[model samples]
Target: MMGQPPYSRTTIDELLRLIERAGLFERQPMVERKIMHYSSLQTILLVGEGNFSFSSALATAFESAENIVASSIDSEDKVLRVYNTARSSIENLESRKALVLYEVDATRLHEIEELSTRIFDRVVFNLPHAGYFPGGECSKEAIKKNSELLSMFLESATKLLSLDGEIHVTNKVGPPYKKWNLEGAAENYGLYLKESVSFQKADYPGYMNKRGSGAKINRTFRLGECETYMFSAV
Candidate 1:
C-alpha cells in the first residue's frame, strides 16, 4: 500500500512562507546558476526537490540543457506544495525547455529512468534531514530509511549519468553528528567522492531575520553548515 503523505497543509504553508521570507528561493537559484557556469555540464537531473525552489535555480543556470528531469514524492499535503512550487518554477522559466518533472518516490530508480529516458550529465540530491518532518522525531528506523532511499537514488542516478557525469549532494549534518555519515553512505553506493565544499555562516545571508542583516553572509560559524560533494560514477 502507498504510505501516508509526508506533509500537512499547515506545515507546507509555513515552510513555504519561511522559504520565501528566508530568501532560500533566491539562494537555490544562485547556487545552481553558479554551478552551471563552473561545471559547464550539458544535462542535469534533480532528485527530491520538495518544492522546485532548487529546481528553479537549475532552470536558470542551464537555459539550454540537452535534458533536465526533476522528481519528488508527493503523497498528501506535500502534493499541493510540490505541485504549486513546480508550476511556479515552470512559469518563471517561460521557455519550452526540455524539462520533465515527476511526482514519484525519489528512491525509485525505475521510475526515474522511465521519465529521463537516458543518462544525464549531472545528477543532484538535495534531501531533507531526518527530523524535518512534522512529528519531529528521529529514530534508527528513520535514518535507515533515509540511507536506503539515498542509496537507491544514487544507484539509479549513476546508471543514468553520462560516462563523465557527476553527482552533487547537499545535506545538513547537525549536532551530535553520530547518526548517519552521508559521505560514507555515498561510498556504499559505489560513488567516489571527488571534492567537498562547505559554505560558512558568513558566506550566506543571515538567517532571514537578524540585527545586522544587510547582505548575505559569507563566513563560517558554529552553526549552519552547508556541505557539497562531487562524486564520480562507478
Candidate 2:
C-alpha cells in the first residue's frame, strides 16, 4: 500500500520554527565564510534540480557558470509548468553558458552519452528523495528504496569523476532519512565518506528546497537540519 506523503504532517522545520517563536529553540549562530566548497574553477554537474534556481544561484555567485552542467529528471515542459521560476532560472544559466539538460535521471547517469564522455570535479545531488512510494517516506521500504537510489547514483557518478573528484549529497538529517544509512551504502559502491558538513541554505542566496514530486511539487519545504555528505572513490 502507498504510504502517507511528505508534508502531510508537521515537518521538523515547522516545529523548530514554532519553538523559536516560543523562545525555546536554541539556534546555531550563522557563520560567515568567504570560500564555499563549490567553485566555478572546477567542473560541476548538478542533478535532480527541481527548478534550476540553485544552479542559477551558483552561476551568479561565480559570475560564470561555464564550468557547470545542471540537469533535471523532469521534462522541460513539466519544469516550465510546475516551477514559476523555472523559465528565468534556465535562462540565467543558459545566458551564462551553463549546460541545462532535461529528463536526466540520477540513477542511470552513466548511460547518457552526453554525460558519460565527460568528467566532472564535483557531481552534486541536493536533497535526493525517491519521491512517494509504497509504505511512504518513513517506512523501511522507503528507506531501502532511497538507499538504492543513492548507491546506484554513487556507482554511476564514479564513472564520470575526474581524478580526486567528489560526489556530494545534501539531505535532511534525522528519522527515516538517517535510517537510509548512506555512508554504509556508499562503502558498498566503493566510496568513502570524505566529510560531512552542515548544509546552510543561506550559503546559496537564491536556492529554495522544493518537494520535487507529488501534489506539493511546486511548493518549498522547511529544511530543519540538513547535512552535505561528501564522498570520493576509496
Candidate 3:
C-alpha cells in the first residue's frame, strides 16, 4: 500500500550510490540495523503489503509466523503476477501458518469477517500513498488523496486496535509526506503520536520496499529519511 514516485531503480543502495556519484548528496556512513520493535509473542497485523517481504522477514526473525497476520489490497493472483518474489513469500507465510489475506482494504479492516473480533498488539502500514496519478507525487491531488486514505485508515484501525496496542505507519519524512500531516489526521481519529523512530530496511532482513503500483510495481524505491510513526489511542 505504499505509493511512490515512479522509479525504475533496483535498490536503495544502488540509487544512493548514483546520487553520490553525481555529487548531489554526500555519502553517509551506513546505518546499523535496529532491533525490530515488534515481538514474536505479540499479535501483529500488517496491512498493505506489496510483496509480503516485510511479513516474511518478521516470520523469519521470529522463527515462526504463528502470531502474525499479513494482508494486501491486491488480489492474491494480482500480487503473484506483479511481484516477482511474491509466490515464495506467500508460500513462506503460509508454511509458517501466518494468516494471509488478499484484497483487504486499509479503510475497512473491521469489516473483514476474519478480523472483526480480533485485536493486534502491533498494526503496521508501511509507505501508504494513493496510487500513481498524472501530476506525480507532489501534486495537490496526490496529497489530498493520500491524506484521505490515511484518515480513513486511522478511523478503521482505531476500532480494531487493542486497548493498549499501537498503530504504526512508516513514510518518508519530508516534503509531500510532511504535507500529509499525519499527526493532525491522527488527532481527528482520537489517536496521538507516541513516538517516531528511524526506519532502516536492514532491520527487516528480507524486507524489500516496493513501488507498489503502476508498471514498476515490482521495482524497489529509494527510502529517504523514512520514519515509523507510532500512534496510540486517546
* Off by more than 4 A, model 2: 1-35
1 or 3: which has the higher TM-score? 3
All predictions: root-mean-square deviation over Cα?
17.8, 21.2, 19.7
Tell me the tens digit of each residue's lDDT in model 3 across 1-234.
988857656777789888888758955543222237888767899999989999998887777788899999999999999999998889999999999999999999999999998888888999997799889989999999999999999999988898899999999988989998789999998899999999999888889999998888888988989999999985
Runs in model 1 with CA error above 4 Å? 1-41, 75-86, 93-96, 129-138, 174-178, 199-223
Q: Rate the local accuracy (lDDT) of all candidates.
A: 0.56, 0.88, 0.89
List model 1 lDDT by residue over 80-113, tens digit each.
Answer: 4324344565554346364545556555655554
Ranking of predictions according to TM-score: 3, 2, 1
Better of 1 and 3 by lDDT: 3
TM-score for each of the candidates: 0.63, 0.83, 0.84
Backbone steric clashes in candidate 1, count: 15
Q: Name the candidate that leads on TM-score.
A: 3
Alpha-carbon runs more than 4 Å astray in model 3: 1-35
